[model samples]
Target chain A: MSDQEILRTTGLTMRFGGVTAVNNVNFSIDHEGELRCLLGPNGAGKSTFFKCLTGQLVPTEGTITFMGEPIAGMDTHEIVNLGIGIKTQVPNLFNGLSAYDNVRLAAKRKHLKRQAIEKTFDMLSNCGIENLKGSEVGLLSHGQRQLIELAMVLAAEPTLVLLDEPAAGMTGEERDRLAFLVKEVTKTASVIVVEHDMAFIKQIAKNVTVFHRGEIFAEDDVKKIMKNKSVQEIYLGKSADAA
Target chain B: MEKSILKDPGLYVMVSIGLLIMIFLPIMMDMFAIMQITQYVVLSVYALSLAYIWGYGGILSFGQSCFFGLGAYTFAVASINMGSTSLPFILAIIIPALFGVLLGYFMFYGRLSDVYLGVVTLVVTLIFWKLINHTAGPQYAIGDARLGGFNGIPSIPILNMPTANGQMMDPIQMFVTFMAILIMVYVGLRLLIASEFGRVSISIRENEVRSSLLGYDVRRHKVVVFSIGCGIAGMSGAMWATYQTFIDPNAFSLEMSAKALVWVMAGGVGTLAGPIIAVVILQWISLKLGQLNIINNFVLLGLILVPLVLILPKGLLPTVKQWSQDLWTIWKKNKANEGDTIIKESETVNAGRRK
Candidate 1:
């Protein structure tokens, strides 16, 4: 176990009803100081995998170790306490509270002191919403809310941050900014981003995992996965003739 | 920069004024009328508790009345059974709080969701109501008095409050006693709403999944928040016991639950101040309405509620907020235009002098 390899899962499996959402999958990462992307098409079980790792859903069969501690059966709150933070695919924000307040709530969980308030503002500034902090998350643009959500997760100071579809509703410029922010986040903690957009994956991810139908289809450098023929076929479909 | 109404001076002023009215209302109004308002306010506390769960925690509890009833019964039984005459009022309060904690532990640890939790609570309330109603027969005796069936524990001892004179309190004194408690409870709730716990509760309401993912003990938080709300409901019940000097199974009925909810709804759900305002207004109206023929009373209620519901879905407070905001904005805009015109004229005058 290295400082970089903060989380690892062995033979993780998740089933819903009769559908095996995540099949037997063994994956580990030697933590690098950069964001990693788990890219897959719809029905590829990326979200399910993220949920399993975050303890939002229990894996039917798996051993998850966070910083060398078994976290498979731990509750979500306990997992978070052990330095894991998750940003949902949908912008899961308190609509009734201002953006600042949403971030403040998360910050208080990390620590509840006046000094923590400054750190929370710093986190919000990092996410590029320090100016619009007081505006309600409901009133914010889709991009701004996403940024606030990012700020919220950052406030927790987790060693491992999982973001699902963070830039789903963001504009191109917003997406680019988010990618940069994600890269910055990786400087302190390993960020595993589950996203569909290739552009974002290419921009931020130093390493990429292409998940295909509940299994790790490919895991390598971003450049290598993009060039891999089978990876492209499975993700983008075979060439026109083959199709 | 994270300024909220809680920090606003105007809010403090408004709260102070409201407190003042509550403090003096009993002196100005008839004893029975003031007692009725106090009961409604107590129910509002229950409503506020529900609002905390529903509006902030995002956990809908249909059986909130369970806690309310539980608190009331706990206080009544404990104080009565112990025969501790000196601190009956205090015992009444403490007992309910204990019940809240006990109930919270069961529901929260059980991992109950909103729908199932609500059903369980409603069933519990009904069961308790039935049991109490049925058990109030021949066997239930306290000292010399017999527990009246369908009729509740009547002749509840007058709440013994300490005053400067060291004399025992009359019924009017009990009104003052409960009124003081109501104010204190309101203030405590206000502070709680502004505390770190309150923030967590609101966050849970906003996004339980996300809040949980961020490391909140969502289930435990729900249970604790629910329990706290119940505890407050219990406090109100204790107050009710003191104010009316009576306790009955009917006090914990479906109608009581509905009225508590109505207070929350008629007041603004999310805002703390809204529940208080709504309770006061609705209680006053309902009292006035009750004076009319029963048939006309309900019809009149519909006439008022229809327009109120239609016009202010956020309740009266939102309407007041909107109206106030509009006025402030117009005033500010006018001030800005005037300043701009003055600046333009001054600039022109400066140019003329240069020429």
Candidate 2:
């Protein structure tokens, strides 16, 4: 492990009885304030790999080291408290609570009461949803809810941030806003995004890791990967080459 | 963030009004009415215990009465042996709280949740009920306080002033103590709900996985909430014991547990005021039913509850609050539209004058 490396996983494998969702894979991020994108086709083990890192799903075989500590099977809260922030694929917010409360609770977890309030409002305004603070998260549109969850994730002040399918249901405007926020987050913390939208990735990603069939298929600069024959073949279903 | 309760003068003013009523209640009512109301007030405290855990924490423990009975039994036995009220009174809350810690550790730490958690608590209450019932033998006596089994302990010491040889409270004074404590519990719970602990507990209830991923120890928060409920229920149970001067194994019965649930569900699952109102109304109906003998208290309760569940799924208070809010919005819209029409009418008249 290098001094700047924030996380490293060795032989990371996840199996569901007969199915190995994530095969033995070694991965790492070796710089502060880095932004990495994970791209893949469906069933490519991107989400499974993300889950392994967050402790949402323990690996059948692997060792995960983060910030110079072994945290493979630690509780999710423990991992989060160690300065890793996570946002699940779908927005799982407190539906009954106001948007302010949802962000405030997350902010409150890391900061003192006054600072938490300040941070909450600051994050809300950053996400451009300060006007919707009083509205219930459950009643908000998909884009609005996605932005709120991103605000919540940023409120924790994590040194490492993980986001899963952040642009899944977002409009073009919402996607650009999310991309801007992800870039801003990368200015202070290393961010790893798992996304299916290549256009969304192009806006912010410089380095990318492609997953295929439960393994890391390729790791390179996003520009090189975009033009690579195999990578394009994998994405366009192999017939784009013949056509 | 919820503004601290201390900043809310309205709550203080409301409680002050409740205090005034407390002072006047005994003077205005007969002893029989006072006694019944006192019991209802104590039961309200017990109901609040469940409301906090179920409504906010989203832990629906069906065995709340087991802790209530534990508190009652603890008070009875401790007061009998000690021949004083002070130590027993404190123990009434602490013992049940300790039990809560133990039980909560198992349920929350073991990752029991939702229906499974509910069933575990229900089974626990039954275990206590059966265990207490079997202790009819003289061997069941701990020191001087008898287990009394199905008969329960009788002539337990009344609540008293803190002294070496305590002076027992008169009926009116006892009534005041019970009423004051109920108000205090209500205030304390409100403040707690506004605090970090309360908000986090609500978050855990909302989405445990999300809360954990955001860096909260969901299990620990849950255990603290459960224990707090136990302590509150225990305190109320002790007061109930003091009022009756007796307690029996029936305190742990399934009926007692169900009654608290019905009260919380019918009154309002989330608000403290709802359960108190529900308890008073339902208990009053129950008293009336006892006199008429037309229907069993529970039968009438079930009849009322089914509709309450069907019509107002959020419970009575929250539903009523929503209705008022909806009505207010409609009124505001109407007022705004009326002003718009008046402005449009004036503009049309000006245009006609110009023509």
Q: Second chain TM-score per prediction?
A: 0.84, 0.95
For each candidate, what is the lDDT? 0.75, 0.89
The per-prediction tally of clashing pairs is 3, 0
Question: Candidate 2's error at A213, in angstroms?
Answer: 5.5
Please tell me what DockQ candidate 1 reaches.
0.66
Off by over 4 Å in 1: A1-4, A32-35, A96-136, A221-224, A227-230, A238-243, B2-15, B22-48, B51-56, B85-88, B105-117, B140-148, B162-168, B294-299, B335-355
State the displacement of the C-alpha of residue B222, model 1, in Å, after optimal TM-score superposition.
2.4
| Candidate 2 C-alpha lDDT tens digits along A135-182 | 999999988898899999999999899998898888888888889989
B249-339: candidate 1 lDDT, tens digit per residue? 8766876776666666767677666777777787778778888656666567678877887878987676788889999999999999999
Candidate 2 Cα outliers beyond 4 Å, as residue runs: A1-3, A13-23, A41-44, A58-61, A97-101, A108-135, A212-243, B7-10, B325-355
Question: Cα lDDT for residue B187, model 2?
Answer: 92
User: Tens-digit lDDT track for model 1 on A44-135?
Assistant: 99999888887888889988888889988778899889988888887888897787878877887768678578878898888877888878
DockQ of each: 0.66, 0.68
- What is the C-alpha local distance difference test score of candidate 1? 0.75
* lDDT tens digits by residue: candidate 2, B207-247: 98898888888888899999999999999899989999989
